[model samples]
Target: MVPITRTVPAPSSVRTARAPRRVTRPAIPGVVLAVIGLGAMAVVSLWWRDTPVIHGFGAMLTGAGQVLGLLSGYGFVVLVALMARLPPLERGIGADRLARWHAMGGRYVISLVTGHVLAITWGYAVTAHESVTSEAVTLLTSYPDVLMATVAWFLLLGIAAFSARAARRRLAYETWYYAHLYTYLAIALAFSHQFADGASFAGNLAARVAWSSLYALIGGLIAWYRLVTPLLMFARHRFTVAGVRPEAPGIVSVYITGRDLDALGAEPGQFFRWRFLARSLAWQSHPYSLSAMPRPDMMRITVKARGDHSGSLSSLRPGTRVIAEGPYGAFTPALSGRRVLLVAGGVGITPIRAMFAALPRRMSEGITLIYRASNPRDIVFRQELDAIAADRGAVVHYVVGSRARLGYDPLSALYLRAMVPGLHRYEAYVCGPAGMTRAVVAALRASGLRRRRIHHETFDF
Candidate 1:
């Protein structure tokens, strides 16, 4: 395994919560139980194939597992569709959680699909022992939709295997994206088969109603997350490119404006996934933090053109229609009760800047911003910070060292009293590269700050 080093600074008060060593034992017992259940059902079904009561009981239990598997499958689809349409989910929520669900859900899908195939195959083998495969194949072929479902299952398995991080890293985003698109096809196939070929749904009215109602709920979530939310966003915030300007080397700021002030109700420190509709940059949809707070009619998305997608954003023209799907995440500093201590590194200062601008006047809450970057050039909105500092008594400490190809930064003892003196009193909000955020949070925690008093945002994904 490749060793992954966490770049967080050592905390003064490290909380020791070690993970349990033996967690896999439960899986063994669960698998054993499942096997026993399957075996008992198979034996009973074979012995009483013609009897309605026995067959129905056996079918009901197996059907429950299959239905559960479909729900998991639907969950996987909904997550994908929603993530694509929302901004805060893709970044602040972290890709790790989504990836975990994808993995576990895939396993459930496999178990369900396997149970479905095995149970049906066993029933066929017992009743039509001589030509099981041939008869099943003939039956499927007779029903075109069933054949489509079989093809869909093959596709689902192939896609599931390809979804491994190793394989995904090798594939282009578009290719990976399209491959997963086959999920909708797979779900359609599976659902159709459940209603058509299965006796569980056909003969039993209650089962059919229950199953259909469950499917409707899943479908509703998918529609809300994907279609309805996006449409509402577009209708309310008709975001058009207000201005596009380069902040630093390759970093472009795209200002956008919506219909009305109240209509585009996004708080400061929130971000959006921006997709510029320019023909050349159509495929480029990325998450960018709002550099400035929402005015009566405008918002800003500042992008550091680093990757293959981001680098092309510099050439985008003004007045470009950018589809923004967001106002997601709970990273805002308002969550914590203590005074705000904003920590920013490099371009990560964008959100911090917005928060400062949007802060209400005559505010009793104390605010301190620690701006850390290699040099002064990397500080995106220095002028704005000066204005904010002058307007409010908010203390702004600018730490510019090791930037501009400079060697080393002297450890400045700024904000030492603010943190250590108060110890457990202040709320620390951090946003930057993963390493920077981790290090800052660690250092703050080390200085006797409570974990609940710390809020951080890392745009690693």
Candidate 2:
């Protein structure tokens, strides 16, 4: 294991006074859900008011299509808003949970769109005494914005296909990220078609205005949070690459130097979407957790060579400009119990390592960290971890070995109970690869911890 040292002094640009306390708002998620539910109710009411009577099968199908289209449009707004990188939602709800919601919501919205297209085409065909295929062609050729809508539908379908687990695994991270940006174009095309042909909006100024307002609100949020905020942060902080130090064979820590970094309010377990302004790296931004505590003028993020983007960070030159978009995620020690248990697997040790150092100095109970690695050499920051554990009077356990060599999984429920008695009383924080994280979480639950007591975040998305 490589030894590391921290001797950098606080820069003059940072405030000498204490940092302000962060106010935690736990009700943001519930409030957001309530707002979504209200919007859905309004959509249903609009359909109910506009669609009073249904006499024939064709009318019924058309009505169903209209309802589906309305809900889907509203859903698109909600979907984009969820991922707008808004601080409240990102910090309050956590990025991982929001990502899960966005993914599941995308599937539902796609299904609704597919059903709308089929039902509308078939219903129009029956009403006009024509075949489904004929009606579809006619709609595309004759209806205002219908061709654009059709194009948008196909784009959405393609995106959904690529977003699947298997497809995502085959594609590079950059490709997947850039492909998802086409969602903005698809939503714009769909919006035009909605106003052009929607029954509820036909000659209804109030309905059109309301729908337009909703879109504008969500668009404004995306513009401000995703675009404007980052620009402002970049200009204010003027971040740059200070240096990069190798930790292991394929892992290195990037030290970022900036102005007034403390003003960014980054906690130990939070992360930033880092965009390095350099050849082949300027266009893509990747999320990397801070491996150490934030300083007034510097911060550190440890990256493992998991992919092309991460692998290339080893070559980053000092003084390279950097654009960061966050201090996001809610995985800090604020939510942990008196007696805390920290679990880390492989590169997941980055965030866990930071939190371990930040744990309260005097705990009534104690703090324990279990690091799972495939081998002794794979253990990162070993010297630093031992130093912190000894200085803080915390316990550090390194579980090193492959499953085959060990003859069993060391992180199983039975083993966890033997390793740490009364595991249920401690709040656990886990970070690691998706498979290992899931296994550890399952083991923790089985060992008597409640779901709420265990916190974890995966970067698989």
Candidate 3:
């Protein structure tokens, strides 16, 4: 357990830059298959309009089945992940990966619904031999199942619409979470429509098997992710608040120690959205990185009291029961090989601190830290940072924002620019406020750093 150490160079200069584009297309094989399958079905339904009504109905049913099957699988995973129900062995995917899946699944589900709408319109056109819109309205109004499907379609649409960053930015995580919870109800409606009226499963034994198999798979996955995993956790570690101390003004650090944390199988630089039973903080959980390396015996999370729920965290008793909903991010230091550049702002220092502490003291890899805070008092782990640097020659630079004579420009871009002389040759780690991380990332890329070389932890965004 020897610590890594190396001589670090002084940072070069600072630059101000805009936030980089954070949007990425999440990879989802199931969703991709559904999109392709639905598109093919749409074509078949449209082309068979003049054929027998049974033929067109059959095509639409097949497409609907494929789309529903795919969406159900991915959606089930998301539900389990959000609920902290996934088994320890299977819950390795972090928030970044989850968000990517969510985005891809969302797009695919919309595409499937769009295909469903188009195919149904064609079916109506062939059956009524008139305006399909009129027939669609008729179907929607006449059948309860059809009505439910339409309602579910609208709900899915709403969820997808608000899932966008622009809309999500305006809502609190709790509101966004609750609003999105309707996804289950929407899917239930979809299930009813599929079983009750879907031609694929109506009278066919194979289709019945297919539907039954889908239910079993989705059901088993749900049980594994939600009920079984949580039950096992409650039986084992059963977390209770060990202590809550203010590490800095308006910043409280909650200490939690439990059995079986070694079995929790988390790494340094990851975070959890913590829940406390206190009435003031119970409604929503807040994401906080383990401020120090987890040592099986105890875990520490440093949280800044920025919002109503977070602000009241200090009021909780030491013995309060707590539920941690994560270990849900992927900013671990394992991916890098060259020297590491760790950057933080305000409360953003937690994950970086963990990585710093976790590294061996004499391992010869270079490390540099650029920590920005409002003032001297706002810094968390100030003594720890000093001690680590003193022991290992880890270069530590502090940017006191409010005290700067240049009138407190956001130091994120500046820090990145200052470090850029050799940064392109090393790995970059950033965790902090979204604005700061964005600015730094943009600055690095604008200066021609490769995107792969820049690594970051998941934050509130």
Candidate 4:
């Protein structure tokens, strides 16, 4: 790889020319969906007025229970819908944003369900003039679906406990992911009781049909996107491993070949959740970004051994079948400005490498890549990156060294502006570990780039 050594002469200190601000609408639809969910729960509460109420503590408790139950049911549907992998919502709202919403919403739904259980049990005890324990036993025995729902409640509670940050840190991604499959069963068992035993739902035919429809629609979406779509693509493409070659220590590139590869509609700078159907790896899947421009019948992904699953990607046998889940993500060339700067850290260089291959070029050089690694020996794809830079005259800067405290960092505001002639006009794409990403983003902002001009591909689960 050719090292960057030439420096643009700095006659004076940096002069900042800010890019004009551009407003974004990525979150508008997501916000509207959230508002509608809250409002729908509010409307569900109105159904309670149609029933007779005792004018005492029992009545208040009963009403609270009904409202909480309503909120949880609504939340369950929305939570599943958000993760159903609906292309429009995922592309518009962003996969990272949707994942955050799903996780946060899960916490609230669990709380609401807990409140519903306690309030309803206490309210029923008061209404029946019985001890809380006996009333709970009676209700559980009397309701047709309550027993299943109780078990479902525990399952949801367990999932919530497993999802805690501390718990997640101890588990492998495969374990954490398989544990999430129980969520579908929990949702089914928990929702069954709403129509069968719900006081507010007893006489409301319209509400029953509406609730049923919501669940059915969400179920259909999940079935299509999560199961059916990928199976169809796998059958059609028949992707198989072609070769595996080492790029650097602990890093390897996997090449895959398939039929009519163009039909996948894969754009550069996108990724797939890949499942290699070989011994011990038949069911587990992990996301990896395309590391090279897509060829009509083949594609390539570079993987660094980061975990048990990732470490196994190097020894895949030739002809092992592959199942892929996407061309999903908005990190393509369409998001670039007239001038573009790409910042990559460690294995984060995967998508940026593909983008560099495909991003539109200006007559004058328009692409700048700043790759950060611990040292020169750790820089993956050095030869290919150099080839692209030399062929296209794109600027390449390798920031390599141990993490050291310094006021004069190469990625600091002044240095970034000095490297790129029109830094303010450049759209910056950053991908790195969380800490490094934050630092680079701050430097880009200080270099006079607007918020809308900075794009980062977020792969955090």
Best by lDDT: 2
Model 3 RMSD in angstroms: 8.5
The best candidate by TM-score is 2
Q: Mind giving the per-residue lDDT tens digits that candidate 4 earns over 1-461?
A: 22112221211101211111232436656575777667675657655565575689987888788888888888888888888888866656657667888999899999999999999899989988989999889879997799888998999999998899999989988788888889999988988798887877788888788888988999999999989999999989988887777778888878788888766777666788899998988878788888864555677888989887789988787788999988776565544356778899989899888877665445235878999888677798777777767766788989887567433576778777887778888888888787778888998898889997887775667
Candidate order by TM-score, highest to lowest?
2, 4, 3, 1
Query: Please, what are the lDDT tens digits per residue for candidate 3 over residues 1-461?
Result: 11112121111101111111222324343454465457446434433442334455645554554344434433543443433434332234456555666577577657767676666666555656757778778878875588887888889889888888889888877788898879878877777676676544455566557555755666676776554654466568777777777777888777776776656666667776677878777667677777754445466777787677777777777667777755656566653354667888888898887777655544235778889887788987777787776666678888775635656464545556675456666667888777778877777676666887787754665
Against the hidden true structure, what lDDT does model 2 obtain? 0.86
lDDT of 2 by residue, 420-442 (tens): 88888988989988998999999
Better of 2 and 4 by TM-score: 2
- Candidate 2, superposed: residue stretches over 4 Å from native: 1-27
Query: Where's the lowest-lDDT run of ten residues in candidate 4?
Result: 10-19
Query: What is the TM-score of candidate 1?
Result: 0.69
Better of 1 and 2 by lDDT: 2
Candidate 3 stretches greater than 4 Å from native:
1-93, 141-144, 160-167, 202-204, 280-283, 402-421, 446-448
Off by over 4 Å in 1: 1-147, 170-172, 197-200, 213-225, 228-237, 360-365, 374-376, 399-423, 438-448
Candidate 4 — number of clashing residue pairs? 0
Score residue 267 of candidate 2 by CA lDDT.
74
Number of clashes in every candidate structure? 2, 0, 16, 0
In model 2, how large is the Cα lDDT of residue 73?
A: 95
Cα lDDT listed for each candidate? 0.61, 0.86, 0.64, 0.78
Root-mean-square deviation (CA) per prediction:
11.5, 3.0, 8.5, 7.2
